[model samples]
Target: MARIRLTLLVREDWRDRYPAVLERCRQAGLVIERELAAVGAIAGSIDEGQLLALEAIEGISAIEPERLNTGLE
Candidate 1:
């Protein structure tokens, strides 16, 4: 299976919904690869169906790939 990475930007007001969203992700077989709380960013991989499920979450602003690794300057 090809792994696809996605970055989700969650709204501040929806912080309370994080747990539920995570549960949903798990139910859909999506694994959270990484998270950056400071930026409200979540990176994960999921199948096409799971991706569609995630899009249903209300506070999800944007979902895209973590395309760049800018670790060293």
Candidate 2:
């Protein structure tokens, strides 16, 4: 299975329920990278096949796959 990098947007003030969120992500087989707490986001990699499962996890607002972009403002 192809692994893709993804950024997961979560509910506001996500730390209050971080443990639940972490468990959910782990269950989705994601290799967690970093936590952006202030913005309620997480970075990680997971099999492409698991995309839908990840999205279905509670509290996830958006799933944005990594993309290529030149330095354009």
Candidate 3:
């Protein structure tokens, strides 16, 4: 059960690497939930341990927990 959801920010300068990043995520055991084109981000879930390895991937700007915003944060 891939219950952990995360959002990955793709660096604007590295948009071309999106495909590679997606593959890396899958290799890390993350089930890609969605891809936000306008924001250059990707959402997915994986085991907690697999996430740490993603930091080694170039072009990934940020990895954050996914949440719905109602403007109250």
Candidate 4:
């Protein structure tokens, strides 16, 4: 499947283990583009097929498609 950009929300309780969580995300096939440890957010791209794998990770609270603002709004 083609890769799609995504935004992951890290659970508040998992903030302390952000690095490890990030590693797990990488192992799950996320090509990390940006990490906002303070807000517990991670932005990356991953195979559409692997999305479920990422969602299965315990530390991740949510997974959303990356949104693009065309400036028309």
Candidate 5:
């Protein structure tokens, strides 16, 4: 199956609500493969519709896919 990375931008004040958001994602069939709290970024791969479900969350500042690396590092 094709996979696409999903990133969610959250505010520092809403950090405590991360669990609820994660649960919502789980119910929507989106598995959170990785999470970075310092930067308030959540990375994961899910189906198209599942990804769209994230928009329902109130505190979500932004959501998008991570850019592919060109391996120049």
Candidate 6:
């Protein structure tokens, strides 16, 4: 399946374990692009079919699929 961009929300309680969480995400096949640590977010791309593996990581609270920017209110 095609790969898609995604934003991962890190659980508040899991912030302290950010490094480990990132490692797990890599293992799940995420091509990490940015680490918004201050906001508890991680931006990356992963195979559409591998989304479940990314979501199953222990510290992730939510997964947001990338959306096109239409530049409209």
On lDDT, the stronger of 2 and 3 is 2
* Candidate lDDT (C-alpha), each: 0.73, 0.86, 0.80, 0.95, 0.74, 0.93
| Least well predicted 10-residue stretch by lDDT in candidate 2 | 11-20
Structural similarity to truth (TM-score) of each candidate = 0.67, 0.83, 0.77, 0.91, 0.73, 0.92
Number of colliding residue pairs in each model = 0, 0, 0, 0, 0, 0
lDDT of 3 at 17: 75
The order of the candidates by lDDT, greatest first, is 4, 6, 2, 3, 5, 1
Task: Candidate 6: count the clashes.
Answer: 0
Greater TM-score among 1 and 3 belongs to 3
Stretches of candidate 2 exceeding 4 Å from the true structure? 13-15, 70-73
RMSD of each: 3.7, 2.1, 2.9, 1.2, 2.6, 1.3
Any idea what lDDT model 6 has? 0.93
User: What is the Cα-based TM-score of model 2?
Assistant: 0.83
Model 5, 2-73: lDDT tens per residue? 556788877677778877676776676677888877677777777875666778776677888878789997
Best model number under TM-score: 6
Cα lDDT tens digits for candidate 3, 1-73: 3367888898898887788877877787778889876677888887877777777777789999878788995
Q: Per-residue lDDT tens digits of candidate 6, residues 15-39?
A: 9999899999999999999998888
lDDT of 1: 0.73
Candidate closer to the true structure by TM-score (higher is better), 1 or 4: 4
What candidate 4 gets wrong by more than 4 Å, as runs, is 70-73
> Between the candidate structures 1 and 5, which one is better when assessed by TM-score?
5
